[model samples]
Target: MNTAVSQQPDAGVLLELDGIGISFGGLRAVDDLSFKIRRGEIVGLIGPNGAGKTTVFNMITGVYRPTDGRIRWHGRDITGLAPHRIAEAGIRRTFQTIRLFQDMTVLENVIAGQHLKMRQSWWQGLLNTPAQRREERELVEHAMEVLQKLDLADVAHEIATSLPYGAQRRVEMARTLVAKPELIILDEPAAGLNEQESAGLNDTIRAIRDAGITVILVEHDMSVVMNVTDNIVVINFGKKIAEGKPAEIRSNPLVIEAYLGQDDEEEDDPLLNAVHDQVNA
Candidate 1:
């Protein structure tokens, strides 16, 4: 990881992955990978398919604990915290697949994302106390505000899973944003959208950043990655190969070779085979 340039001592780093790695059985899925994310910046984590991008996301979000290295949240050692605990600690993430509530209205679905921050206890909800009602009203107001920001307010009362695919993606993002996380990890948010929808996504992501939330975006769309990110961290076979501004990453010989090289199938086969054997072992 050539990251000396990326790790500034004075940069307001919100998250740090120090030599983080994970393995499956005996197969190393991710090696010693590291990067620093400054607060309020959109950082792109990109590589070819099967580059362990989502594995890194899983480790950061506590779906998978790292076999090596430390993960720090705002200078606190948060390695191996349970997923709910991590979410409570002001970190949230979206999945590659949209996970909206099937039957809930869009506003209701987004309001649910704030459960970790809900002040009313279960007993209060059970009792339908005045305080609980007040809290509910406040949360509903905030969720609608977030939906307006995501351009989904018009559909706030629509069934969430019934919206168009692009709108569903925005709903998932609206759900994440409603939580007010300090850092949001988006896993391929633009995966199924057309060009216009992708363009809308770019604006939405920038709005999130401008609101002072640091973002770690794992995306395959080059236009989105190149147009939106403040910095890019490139990986292949689970190792950090490049980290810099998008323009710099765009021209780097190593990154170009990794993405455009003719022999990638052969190059990636060894690690692919190792993971396959591990899964079947």
Candidate 2:
């Protein structure tokens, strides 16, 4: 699956997952899934538990190689590039759970995200060469600008993990943003946020898109996805069941069936009613 690509996605397309599938031992985790993201779009990949959302993330980010298909970045196949190489290729992601440096200040944690861009040799570091010092200073300067951009500059000196839960999540995002990814993948970015916090997240996501970053998210919080994403892709048992606009997916019979079983009587069904009310809210 290792490929060398040298071309562009036709027109505005940024990334394409063409018939991608992956397996764990003999069990298929994702099957024949395909999607394309145009530049500056926010798309959501969602499904019920164990529906293979994260597996698709792993494959796209090069943590796993799709046994069945190729992943293209700007029309260049990047199916089996090493994870670091993929990061170097302007793709980065944040985990479902916040992962931050407990011992480092928020600014340090974000600054560390630039590890991939560090170019000084080890010897240069040992001697504290002028070029190395200049590079380090530049990284700090760039990280500070990102912190300000993300509204975290005031807490930049605080320990990353000591911040409130929502702020910690923003720190993780700041780290990812400091990497300057053209395509950012978010896994449940609003998992534990309260209503107010989640609403703020909608704005953050849009700002990222407006800043010319394409986003793909796997989120269990339907409200966040429905409100934040430009398009939604739904999957069940590793297969796509529906892909469409929020209003369309909110009422799709296939989506309702996937969330609630097919045996529902379709009358005054509280669970079904709740799902409809919740997502549409």
Question: Which candidate has the highest TM-score of all?
Answer: 2
Candidate 1 displacement at residue 52 in angstroms: 0.6
- Evaluate residue 154 in candidate 2 and report its C-alpha lDDT on the 0 to 100 scale: 98
Candidate 2 lDDT, 1-281, residue by residue in tens = 43775566778898988999988898989999988888888999987777899999999888998899889998999988889989999999999888897799999999989898889988999999999999989999999988887789999999988888888888888899888899999998987888788888888888788777899988866777878888999988899999998889888888887877734455354334546676556
Each candidate structure's count of clashing pairs: 0, 0
Question: In model 2, which regions exceed 4 Å deviation?
Answer: 5-8, 262-274, 279-281
Question: In model 2, what lDDT does residue 150 have?
Answer: 75
* Candidate 1 residue-wise lDDT, 152-227, digit = tens: 9999999999999999999999899889999999999998999899899999999998887889998867778878
lDDT (Cα, 0-100) at 36 in candidate 1: 92
TM-scores vs. true structure, each candidate: 0.89, 0.92
